[model samples]
Target: MKTVNLELFNNPNTVNKLSIAIKNESEKLNKPIKIMHICGTHENSIVRYGIRDLLPKSITVIAGPGCPVCVTSSKDIDAVINLSLKKNVKILTFGDMLKVPGTEMSFYKAKSLGADIKMVYSVFDAIELARSASKPCIFFACGFETTAAPTASALRDINIPDNFFIYSAHKYTPNGVYALLKSGKINMDGLILPGHASAISGLKVYERFVEDFNIPCASAGFESVDVLLSVLLIIKQINNKKPKIENGYKRVVNYEGNKNAQKALEDIFYLTNAVWRGLGNIDLTGYELRKEYARFDAKKQFDIVYSDNYIEHQKGCRCNEVILGNINPTQCPLYAKLCTPQNPVGPCMVSDEGTCKNWYDGGIE
Candidate 1:
């Protein structure tokens, strides 16, 4: 990354100007327009800069399922925990999964209870450890397209150690969002598309959605000005009754996106039916390792199966509804009182991208 002037992109003067313009443009609407964002980084930028506060009363912004860790199902977490408990088996994952409360218990709890768990920065790190150790090592992978591309690359390019395997919980965000839209679960006037995710998938993949649904969408970057400007563009389209896909984050994203990364993803993984936490079994959203790469699949190698009777360990966490945009983070009874970041009752509070945790940390979105 280069040390560029962030002050220019997050400029307060520009944001204020955009805010006033958005409010003025929003007046053309007979009713309040609800805008939804599908990236956790976008939520962070919105809350961090108090972008929601800058919005007009007529425009409501809802944060959708953008956080990868927040959407990882409890049954998946429990499956990984069970693997960690196996004798001579080591489970590797990013740090965010440590405290995400699963149906039974969290990986953090399992680690404390003497599970052979390792926090690794990358899949190759786990592979190195697996090569050194006598026992099998499993990488518990959970992420959207942003992280999944690299995981796919590691599988396709690297020579896999026999003991190194992956338990994939990778998903495609646009597919998941399409499921929400098709199900009539969320009401979105416009969509502020994910900037980072757009870099992987490119803006073209969303064209079918734009054409079919006629929803105004702008591929957005994670900055105050980028988001605010995208909002202005959306409001313009909505007011004109013109629905088109716009690439507002052209600095980072293109129509085709990172083709090499997409190719790598295609080479090692295939789309499968995925079960989202709130949205149940959505079709053609989840990615599993390709059949050719089955030797590196942790789920297959360990014969891991999600238990039917696994319980919701958190009694009243409304993360599912929160992810669905049906309820705000503060609407959940467990928001700040019981689901503090130090002790998160839900996955929403466990990641910086989570809507509930961002609200709790940023205070009154």
Candidate 2:
């Protein structure tokens, strides 16, 4: 591995070089460049620093199905809410999960309505709470591969009491991205792949996109400079008529990724079909608890009945189009009108990582 000049990434000269590269590539292509970034954190960064405004008109960046909270289906949210409302059941989950709206109400609203729901930073925190409480504790597990490894690690080490179980709605990032590409719902020239997810799944996992789809894929870091450099690399690849996987975030990601973490995930969970809020049922995109850990699976341990009533998004919320990159957040009729962050009508407005929320927070149109 060669050392990157860290100063070069931040220097004004490097920014100028990247800008020139983008301008030249746009001129050469003679058409608009569409690059999709598959991470909520990336979307937040782009909006926070006005990266979208700084880019050339030919370059259009769209947010992909990156937000775990945004993608988590309404039915799952309802199930968790139901668990939370049970007098004997105490719901524990990450802070982001608290505000995400279900069909009727959010967990925060449920907590206000006399539910025993507590926000936890980690899965282990839930285990600790379960150890102390005499009541049944259920953790609403949600996230992509980057967060899944840690949850799996906690499950592997922690001794879950009879009253402790996990209601897992966790999904894998690669599978969702692959599903999006295969569905052809959105047209994308290249992918600014997630750095954190690639650090766990490795760069090689995205090789199929380059080989089969002929799409240029680059794993990008979080910084403004790193993202700009990644955009330049993608533009250069498109101009050269070469579509391949590149690692702009080489500092963290490798070809193979974290072996121990991968192994731990494999040991505890298996792939299953998942229902994303916006993307419907994507095959092999979800994680299920291993049979060995069936005792700690909330669905199995609890006598709760799965609701037959289907949970759907609010009427007129174009969150599906927003997630698919077909339209911007402001294009939604309900956006900021009936759907401000304070009074959210859809999942996109509820989650902090959501594109609509990010756009709203930055006052971006």
Candidate 3:
């Protein structure tokens, strides 16, 4: 049991050396390379530290569908809101989900109008709150594997209250990335995989990306040197034409990931085609509670029906394009003007891990 030296990862001298190595590697190919990292935290680190500015002109780092809050479809938001308002169900969610604009209204707005939406820190909080509550409690479960694994573990290990249920908007990152690449919506030479999610899912799930798409993938941590080192690894892989899934954040992420967490996820839920906010529906990306876990599933227990036609982004909000890495926040007309932290016009403006929010906070321009 040893303490991690946080300073070692962010050491200026170490970061400078990594950046130099990235530059040298980029110079070897002398060709434009687009590397997309599908993680909100990675985007925050990149923008917060001005990682893009440190890169060579030939290399471009863009964000993909990373933020769970940003990608949680409006239909799901509307469903949860409907449950709170119409059915008189008590809703529990993360603070970030409160501000995310839904089809008709947001959770914050819903709460203002007498909806019982309580923000909790985790699934355990929701479970504890439901234990004593008379009314049905529905947890608006949102996130990728990192968060989903915990939710699965809670339901499996804990003596969950019978009144508690989950409306899952959880997604599988590997399949989502795969579907995005298959659709030809994004064209990138390499990918910087998510660290936290990969820690739960492992690098093995991403081997298909290298095998089929011939893309170099590196799992990265949320630090200046870690990002730069991941970039260097991808660049080297591209230069050598050796595309494979490499672990840049080796301390946290492993090749097979956490077996217990994986088992919990497999035992609790199954993969299905779920809708992403701006990016329509991707196959086998969303999670649904298994038949055995029906009592704990809000969609099944409450007989919830999701609408086909739902408003994803507000008018003039380019959140969909932003999620796809097709455009940056500055490209949106409502970015800083109509969409601020205090008052967000789109889903991307709401969450901390969101690209637009990170860009606004960083204000790189």
- Give the best candidate by TM-score: 3
Q: Which digits, one per residue and each the tens of the lDDT, describe model 3 over residues 66-129?
A: 9999999999999779778888789999999999999888999999999999999999999999
lDDT of 2 by residue, 40-95 (tens): 88898788767776678999999988888888988888887886677578999888
Alpha-carbon runs more than 4 Å astray in model 3: none
Q: Write the per-residue lDDT of candidate 1 for residues 120-187, one digit (tens) a residue.
A: 88777777888887888888888899889989998888887888889999998888888788878876
- Quote the RMSD, in angstroms, for model 3: 1.1
TM-score, one value per model: 0.96, 0.95, 0.98
Could you tell me how far off, in angstroms, the CA of residue 24 lies in candidate 3 after the best superposition?
Answer: 1.5
What residue pairs are clashing in model 3?
none
Give model 1's TM-score versus the native structure: 0.96
**Model 3, residue 359: displacement in angstroms?**
0.5
Residue 208's lDDT within candidate 2 is 91
Mark the 10 consecutive residues where model 1 has the least summed lDDT.
305-314
In terms of TM-score, which candidate is stronger, 1 or 3?
Answer: 3
Clashing pairs in 1: none
